[model samples]
Target: MKKMTAMVMALVMAAGMTACGNVNETSSNVGAKIENTAEVQTTDEQTEETQNSEGAEMSGIDGGWIIPDEIDMDKNPEARAAIEKTFVKMMDAEYEPVALLGKQVVAGTNYCILCKVTSLYNHTRQNYAVVYVYEDLEGKAEITDTMDITLGNTENGYAETGAENIEGGWSISDEIALDKHPEASAALEKARETLVGAEYEPVALLGTQAVAGTNYCLLCKVTAVWVEQPTYVLVYVYEDLEGNAEITYTTDFTLGDADEEYSETGEEKMEMPNPWVEYSTAEEAGREAGLAFNVPEKLGEKSIYLIQAFDGLAEVRYGTEDNEISYRKGREVDDISGDHNDYNENSAMEIDDMTIYLRGNDGKVFGAVWNDDEYSYSYYAANGVSMETAQADITALINENK
Candidate 1:
């Protein structure tokens, strides 16, 4: 469960990165740099100074690696070099590279470099690199470079796949074998059995429901009942070119110890101890906590059950009951931002007991809620404009300043 929670948190963080204008650039040199190009005006530190002065900023989660204003390029010729050095120390590991992909771009408000690396010797480490440089009207270069190596479930971005647990700490299979197998000793053997038979899929990339990657297979355990809606046990399955398979199982049911009324008098119902720790059958209410099981109605019978998985190393249950805001098919919205084109349109709403913004057809955003009948957008536009509008104004100001 801890592993699943971590994975979900990582995905949430990644979503934040995308929403924050993440520019996924690639670089061949995990930490190396091109030399003798353009004018040699000042060192990399000076370059960082120039870039910082010019207003180039990097977000907190730059794929988990932060490029300081200045890099010790002499220590490592490229960003990849630096990344390798840092990774070895961080992961306490050694790796033999199996594959590498690189790219470069030129002539735009920003220039970028991106890279992806795969190592056969280690299954836990998946590495990526990025370098971004942009110029303002003044032509001052603002640069940002990062090399991040995410641990846990490394999959080839191609078809359905599963990650192998190497030295770096991708925790997909450890718990299943160590804790779930009959007295824990049957873990690996069970994984081999399940994985060899299951199909793998690449983790989803561009959507809210996007799983960590498109390369890992969602392993389903056939344990009784229907082949259709609402009943299934899913595990993550993966294999190497050698045909070795691994499976990590998870549960998506919320179990409640007791059903109690909300303590609060208002519409916003709140409860404590969350009896629904793992799952709830009621679609209109309840949630999938973390605990799950595989019980056979009879021997050799196959059944289907819903299973939820995440991208990071932790487990997280969907919020259920009170506020009962379940986003099943719709895109989950976050970091709500937009231009304040109109004042009256920007408001808030309460939808299905959950607080959500009622975005207009015109793209203006408002806070609103669903009253089971229609939307009631809030009209508290402050003494000033909304944050979205304020950001737009700031951008205009920056351009004007430029």
Candidate 2:
């Protein structure tokens, strides 16, 4: 990651969006540049460039960064001593060194250590971060920068599943719909009344986690008071049982070129976090899960896009995040997709000599579950539909002849 890249990009691009939370990607020096002088400077520098004087042409490396043969902390005591001297408790994030990634030699030594970051707010969620520690000729060590290594969800942006997170952690999932969640909408409005400087348009209701109170993570399209081009931010809000809500935190991210790309595609896109589920294709998922599954030519006459995964079990998704057909397949276990939500309607359809049970609200069908002697399977439609549509879709999935 480029240190001070944001500092330079902010001035270059006129940083339309900035946040009050942790700026994780390379914010070392803000106002000063690390010069080429022989002086052993130890403070965070402002320059985006990592300049190496003698090590430039040593290994066909054009970026002025070098990789030494030995980087073990035990082998290189400097690495161990440097972290001990520089590692400090952060406000929102804390880092534990995993290994020395690499190093750069400038006026002082800059070391990049791979670290496991524990969220101070939600201790249950942990992710990787690259920590940059600068050690000077005087043997003084100080942290210069940190870059979080987070991936985005395929449906939304990057993050693990909402089903996996606890309180204080951000669950960047596309499963929760903002339009369907009145509580999140209410909490956002409650917090928005207090936010005076920026305009936030809700993009996605990531999910809700409960600690002492309930925490809601939202993906919002942000525009400063100046109508200064829209940007994206993940806004965290806390709601008490009494319905009192307040903004807890905000972090900015970019998923693609522009915000309209999502609106145009008709997907409830999140900022650049990976889907909570592992992203893989139908064929790849079948290989990983050790089961051969078929894709429908047209599920209920809807030309759906299929993306499936093997996260403990097979999770197959069809259609967009808004109106999806969720299909799950695995060995020897079944319950209303593991959730306690009950549909008012339930029925059974005999297809290909297998009894496919269906469930939904009112007289429509939104859920279906069945099992062979070998495995259990389920299919759910986000928006309820006619029982024939569910049966047709199930037939298309199971019987290639249909």
Score every model by TM-score.
0.21, 0.32
Global CA lDDT computed for model 2 = 0.52
Model 2 quality (TM-score): 0.32
lDDT string, candidate 1, 20-85, tens digits: 645222112212222111110111121333234222222211121222222223322343342242
lDDT of 2 by residue, 1-402 (tens): 211222224322322323232222321121121111111111122232322323111111233344334434555666767877864545334566655645656556666665556543234556544556667777777665544543222122322222333423544333434667878888889866844445677755655666566777675666553322343455666677777776654545321111222211112212222223454466666566566655664565465466654433456677778887877665544442533357787788799999888788888888888877776677888887787788778887777422
- Name the runs in model 2 displaced over 4 angstroms: 1-280, 336-339
- Show where candidate 1 strays beyond 4 Å: 1-222, 225-230, 254-381, 384-401
RMSD of 1: 25.1
Score candidate 1 by lDDT: 0.26
